[model samples]
Target: MAEETADDYLKVIVFQLKEEEYAMEVDYIQSIERMQPITRIPGVESFIVGVMNLRGVITPVIDLRKRFNIESMEYNEATRILVLNKDNSEIGFIVDGANDVMDIPASKIEPTPEVVGGVAEEYLRGVVKLEDRLFTLLHIDKVLNKNNEEKRTVV
Candidate 1:
């Protein structure tokens, strides 16, 4: 086997939530789109706003702020839907906006620090130290995992 380079491990798509910048792996991102009409589901969790018809397929819409326990903000022109695929399930995350795609070398990435609060530590894949700032890379699997577990326990 050959040694892995910094390019071999990390891939990211940056976006905004509550005006703060964040990113997740490009592999987990299915699509991004403008906000659309969503059908609210009664009795669902607060984070789960509702579902949307995406070219005839229904996809659940989640308020990323609520999911991460961040303060909610009103949607603006920059608002977008980040569709994520996890464990064969599709979930659409509503974010403040979408930013550019960044390829951070694995060497530049560090384990998520314990200082970041509200956003669960398990939800973070790592932190990428850029030229002047740090970008938190979210672990979609762990974030979605918690939601799936909640659903199972409720049933």
Candidate 2:
């Protein structure tokens, strides 16, 4: 019934990557899935866990823990794969879990400070503070660019 200004608010999908929470614009997300068998690929970046079949599509999966250089952990019932469509290609990020879809007002987002814990600044767009909780909003372009540019595959 009313116009929604893109700059006035953001709709993000929040997910856990260790103890901290991270978010990405829901526009980029295709689906959230339970952990599935990822067939290993050789010679790609260590963070790129492998590929998995989603229905009929073979999607590459990246382990967020490994990507952020976080300590490795076992994938339990809580583990999830965040499938995202970038440049018409689907890629999945394996995270601790994905739980919420929240709408955050633009005024609540702050530019990332000089120093922040976990995940690199290059991969971050900004930080969102909602009440007492903080969420690191991901820079999907930068996060997905490396994978797209490299297009690495080795036998």
Measured by lDDT, the strongest candidate is: 2
- Which stretches in model 1 have alpha-carbon errors above 4 Å? 1-9, 147-155
Root-mean-square deviation of each candidate, in angstroms?
4.1, 4.9
Query: What digit string (tens of lDDT, one per residue) describes model 1 on residues 1-155?
Result: 77778667677889987656788888888899899999999998888999999878799999989888899988888899999877777889999899978787787788988888667787887888889867788877777665543333554
Give TM-scores for every candidate, taking all chains together and pairing residue i with residue i.
0.86, 0.89
Tell me the whole-model lDDT of each prediction, alpha carbons only: 0.83, 0.89
Score candidate 2 by lDDT: 0.89
Q: Candidate 1 clashing pairs?
A: none
* Candidate 2 lDDT over residue span 20-122, tens digit each: 9999999999999999999999999889999999999999999989887789999999999999999899999999999799888887889998898867788
Model 2 TM-score, 2 decimals: 0.89
In model 2, what are the clashing residue pairs, if there are any? none
